[model samples]
Target chain A: MLIRRPAGVVFAAGLLVIAGGTAGLLLTRHSTPALRPPPAGVAALPVPTGPIVAPPQEQLDKPAPPVAKPVSLIIPLIGVQTKLVTLGLNADGTLQVPSTTAVAGWYTGSPRPGAIGPAIIVGHIDSVTGPGVFFRLSELRPGDHVYVRRADGTTVEFRVTAVQTYLKDKFPTEAVYGATPDAELRLITCGGVFDAATGHYLSNVVVYGTEVD
Target chain B: MRIVKFQLTRWRVTVLLAFLALLVGIPAVSSSAAAATTTGYVALGNLSQTPSPVDVYLYSSGNSSPQLVEPDVAYGTILPYTAVSPGSYSVKMRTAGSSASSTPVWSVNLTVKAGGSYIVVPLRTSAQAGSLQVIDNNLTTPSGKAFVRVIQADLNQQKVTFHCSCAKGTAGDIVTGAAPGTVSPQAAIPAGPWTMTATGPGGVGSLYVPLTAGQVHTEIVISGPDNSILIENVLDAAGAGVAPVGGVSTGFGGTASHGSGVPLPWLALIGAGILVTLASGLRLRRRRLTAKG
Candidate 1:
């Protein structure tokens, strides 16, 4: 042989690594993770008391930094990437959804991503044409990562904690829209059986996450 | 004789008119007293070495008569807000059951505003020798968060900054530059268990506080037993949760009825990729064993 035996073996090994990696990517690329049980909403902690004696010296968290507006969102788990549009309340007091299924939106009424409040992002499950930006939203399982790119060109990562499907008629307004004790993110879209008569879905799929980085 | 009778009749008419005027004046005085009073509120706290169980009196501007507002309030005690008519007044501290004529141990000129709430406390030394600190209590509960402001009443900690000590907490000072007798500006904070710390040149102190959504807290850094720095929590408002403004409306029904599920090519590609990986793994294992042999 023109090449040494060791070199030939090494070259084959490199090819195997590449092929195996590509295969692993392809296998997980349009797949969904197993759905987990819905997560309970944030809980209220017990009130703490002041010291009866002199308190000990200690350090505390620094002041929160100013955060810029978010521009886009990416969820590699279910293959979602899109520009974010600013959303506000409609005339009927309902939250505005994205105009087109190709994109998603962030609610202006809620705090921005990375702020110490529940940030809301909404998308469409499907359109008349085909799948929407969040078509595989239900496929998101716990431990999945969602990255949000901010106006300042920085990114904040969040980890999914739960994915829940709630009937539209009985939405938990406070739990879904209320304040949490920490910075959190909520991703919403349509789910459940589609109503042919009304041309809408009977339920909504919501994914809850907290800032991990 | 007729002239004399006419004079008598004129005198009687004058008396009748005077009686009618008196009847009208009585209701005018009564209505003014019965009308709605523009009122504010005030609470008392004894943080100084003031002897406990003291009586508090309010003397309105230009009025000498005193109104006994709070009585028998002990040291380290903060009285709840009491309704008071909005006006210029003076608050005086006296020994419990002390006669109104007795000299006051501590007094301050307090002007209140309608619909406003306030807390007044005597700081430093005995009540007879200390000054008063007026704290504004008119604060709204933050939406989906808690609101807090610290009162620097510690004997040694002159100026301090407070923040939460937690990895999951929001960063930065919750309240800064809080000095003795000065109420810091309101700060909106995350609702959670917080190990709050106060830091400054005078000294540092730690406190554990659990704040809930839609709450307003007043952190008073007072002198503890044996002159140790202590922190106290005074809950102003504790309404839970937040207001609901909007809900989600997402998606159209076009693809929902007849599901266009995952395409076959993608699945086929995934299967092929798995096979390729498995074959590669087997070949690598065989090659490694051959080398070892």
Candidate 2:
């Protein structure tokens, strides 16, 4: 018995595929929005005057030693240990990624990993075949450890402070690359769905770390 | 009869609209001007061991008179940031409700420059008494993160190492060799409840602080004669929990900002760091609370 509606069967199967894909996309997407503004009267103080003692800010020491360039990255938690290649802005002013996805790259514009300011490193999650260098980046948790070897034969260890993900359209630029008072490290990678049309990932995964000195 | 009841004519309506527009536009103009004026910030915290309250006096430089500003600040308490005009100022602490004529317990002078923020805490130990543990709280508050510093103002725990032995990346000595009346440098950590330990020579005291995103905070450490430590987390600046947009052109590699030959990402990141926080209702970055380098 032949029911001659092959086109109808093909259309129904397409619909099911789309329905399941949509459900999966919604289930896996990150939902947290950008930071919300705190309520009023919560930001700062009222009128001034306090106990007649000394000013506490004076206790800080701002001096720092000379910085050394980063040579390699070591994230033992994720089994990532690779030499770092310097990255710069493309002519279009976007940060350049490494030509290959197997090795990670460090953004040359940022300070070195052991420096006083923030140093940034980026990698890919995957390519057409197997897992990329930062495939396990999103699996890192707070209190994890990542190390960077410097040109001066010193290794600076960094502790994970936070792990966050953001939509590429709403990526947190300041949160990932802002100037800090102490030595810090930032790791970046692409995550979420791959857009066949755009040839890019839809989200960015960022990891923040502090020096363990 | 209907025409007699009608009040607003076209001409009259036009005049009323003009007046309302002027009223609305005036505030917009004035608020923009006010945002341009840069002022300094000063936050005060009480870290003494005594139960008696203390009064804080902030006298303008060169003035000898006692001008009471903050009164009855209890131990382990930190007040919000006080917006201050940029200038030299001398602050004094007195016993609560004590007369201005009475002898002051401690005094210190500090310069408040435009856009600077400072935290001042008093020490109660005889060795460091009358001294302040100040940590310059002028750091950028990126979205989704909090900036923090520790003030080792405890009297009994003279020298201590503050450790964050948590399961997360904060598991290490955040501050080392923090002598009494000293403060630690700023550290950026995730926003949440963080448990830390102050390990001194005699005992180990526990501290806990709850922090939110987009603000600067200070954890004041104090101890009684029994060596029991108390920690008070205080807000220094409300950067208003807002993140600065635009950096590194991460997703914009295909956008017009990239192809347009814009000197971006580098300039964009700097702009983001200098962004004035709009969380003004919380007395946030609206006061032009700039950090000193």
Candidate 3:
């Protein structure tokens, strides 16, 4: 007669084998999948619409100097080139635009060059009609370089340190403009996923740079 | 001969007298003709025998450019040696070498008399450690109101205290505005280099305060309290407070006696829950395997 294994041992062995098989199957099923390339021709898309409604007298006025002419801006790492404009307080005490029309410039009311204050520079990421200057501002990364040339022929260079976004209501005004000991630069533009419901941009993109040289 | 000599001597004496009278009369006439002018001086800061260098400038409504009396002078140093006419003047002070980089620490306006000496002391001092009391006089209803208090203590005892007081209703109101409970002296605290803590009726809201002298600074937050409580340094000029100053508000709509509670991040809690569940599942599987073996 053939030797017969105990029923308990046989059952235990059968269960162990089943458990191992199930664990293996699960491990295989839950493995991460490889990333696939985006579909072709996906880069092209319609421009985003923003909330600022044009006034009836929307005729473009003479373009103001991009930031005060005395200051020259250059970002070596990011390949950014622009001028500064002087900004002031809006009628409602909000940040004033350099010009009524779309343009880039430094806020005149802001701190002067080489002064220890928040030097602000604003640019249009995209015009209502299409992409304007600073269209690729969102692509800038930390360690990118920026240079500011003053009228006195002296140039001050800055390095990208941080980039952040905040809702219009939650912008830290004092922290951005209040007195600081070091020379800093702040570049502001609209950012975040565009929302169709609100005419206004969902968030503001602020790029902070510190004087490097 | 005697008569002639005596007459000549008398004439000489009369001429000398006339000359003296003319000299005295000319000064009297000129003094009466001109407008009266007075002189005054404005002394900046506490006048110390050995004054520290204090910048002094003269600002007058009459003049467009403020005259720099002493570009930088010691505490007791006098500036614009000339008397300042009657008018209002503002005295400003900054630590030496402070410019656009460093903001002025003290500024005060003084009304000076036409001919008087005005002594000004721009007290700029730091508070070490002391009890601060904030009394809210806005008691119109019976509901209680919550206020946030930030305390900066040495050795990292940064704490946020919450206090609540009931609104004193009018004697006429029989229902609402009853006397509320005694406000709590402190709020929930966490490990902190805690520079600031803001308390509201809903919970402790956003907070920001600068560290000073290696000590943490505290803030009182009132949620939705439109009116801000003015914290001033009584020892300094009128309306002067510490640097990097801030205020908090009590929230709107609640019974008013609410306090800003300690907030726990939802993401952290969710993560913890997930971790616990995963651990429990692993433990159960191991136990089952051991039991079977």
Candidate 4:
């Protein structure tokens, strides 16, 4: 048997739903900027008390070799071969994306490919019209070969190690940019659900690789 | 004719003695004041377990007398810094209480550049073999910034990670996998107070370094009780090309007035040793002649 609700009860329930939604919108607006500065309790402490017995200045250590710029990128498994462009840090300190959707970009701030640290490359998964470069980047598997041609006329090969997708707000900056004992590479692109209201993707897909002999 | 022959032999002996005297006197007469103007500093540390209380001496190639720079320096202890002429030096390590003429257990030669600073570390490879490690100081940093390079000096400890103590995002790792005697690349950071934590075998050790603007530093790894790892803060020079004008003198703990041509005691000792050895040789030769007659 179908039960009929009173008009007054139905109206009150609708009002309650609207109030709950308004509260959720307020919470989301307040917490959008997730990255916050450290609290006062965790502030940097003062230096120790005593004489500063530092060694005297002398000649600098031997200069490190200059890193070569990457000219092109090739991923055999995904049949991706495209010319590369240079990218730099944005005004907000975030990594800048390449202008074109078909080609990838190597971050200038990161160590170059084959250098003794992790180098970063970023591309777009899609554009306003259609699918863009690195659209199938998340499909890459372990042991896939990634080749990068350098301006110095040498090619560096890397093997994919891991693939992970993380929310944009939960990005691991240090792991991607930190120093390493050997040469490494990071391929990044946008992925996951796209919000029409915000006009942005919710997460990012990252592929980690290490240089092969 | 016999008198003539005897007089000729006497003249020959006099000539030989004179030549010996010249050889001994030349180094003694060389101006040591000029050498001090281009001098550098060297600090000696005894990190070896074989010779617990060791005495160290520094000598050049042509110099016969060795200057006792470290007198009975115990294991895991570093003697104060000493001013040395900028040149190649051979270091001789002997057991404590050994005589001045005793044979040294270990010896190694190293070169110090002019106006440069260095640390000489004597390490124990095993019960049988030991070696001396020389570390050049890198004191240059970006303007209004401070630089730090962490090193793993204790061979017993495997590896260590040096980073800010607060949290992950505060700053990245200053150094990673700092092996024994291996220096990390310099990380130029903001000039301020920093609490660094070192995580390694057994446990973690931390240190607080107050980095002044335009200064550089190195934090060396040390072994604490029960195989724990610790860090010892060592200040690097002010900068590579920038000399400290009125601050603490370069090298260990120098208080000598700059530009003053103060005579080093070691220079005098070398001169005395040379003269004594030459005089004794001449006396022995004369005695041999008397016995033969």
Q: For residues B158-177, could you state the per-residue lDDT of candidate 2 as single tens digits?
A: 67888764436564677888
**Candidate 2 chain A, run of 10 with poorest lDDT:** A46-55
**lDDT accuracy of residue A201 in candidate 1:** 77
**Per-residue lDDT tens digits of candidate 4, residues B74-189?**
65565434657778888888898888678887778889776466767676544565577776764444645666777665667667778864334546588777655565677777
Chain B in candidate 1 has what TM-score?
0.58
Q: Score the docking of each candidate (DockQ).
A: 0.09, 0.03, 0.01, 0.00
lDDT of 3 by residue, B45-149 (tens): 322212245554556755545655444554322221134667777666555555523444555676656434343443211223221122111101111111122
Best by lDDT: 1
Q: Give the CA lDDT, 0 to 100, for residue A194 in model 1.
A: 67
Q: Which sections of candidate 2 miss by over 4 Å?
A: A1-213, B1-37, B50-52, B64-67, B124-130, B142-144, B165-171, B224-226, B240-242, B247-293
Residue-level lDDT of model 4, residues A112-164, one tens digit each, is 78754467888887777666767667777778778888887667888787777
Q: Please write out the lDDT profile of model 3 over residues A28-79, one tens digit for every residue.
A: 2311122122123422322222221111111111111232243545544333
**What is the per-residue lDDT of model 1 for residues A1-213, given as tens digits with 9 covering 90 to 100?**
412455445544544544454444344332333533322221121122221111111111222356789898887656677899998777766788889989999887666776654688999988887889898787888788788878877777787877777777766555556543335688999876566667777677888776763
lDDT accuracy of residue B244 in candidate 2: 27
Going through the candidates in the order shown, the clash numbers are 6, 17, 37, 5
Model 1: docking quality category: incorrect
User: What DockQ number belongs to candidate 2?
Assistant: 0.03
Tens digit of per-residue lDDT, candidate 2, span A10-93: 333433443443344334343323322323443232211222111223222211345678887877656677789988767655
TM-score of each: 0.41, 0.41, 0.31, 0.38
Docking class of 4: incorrect
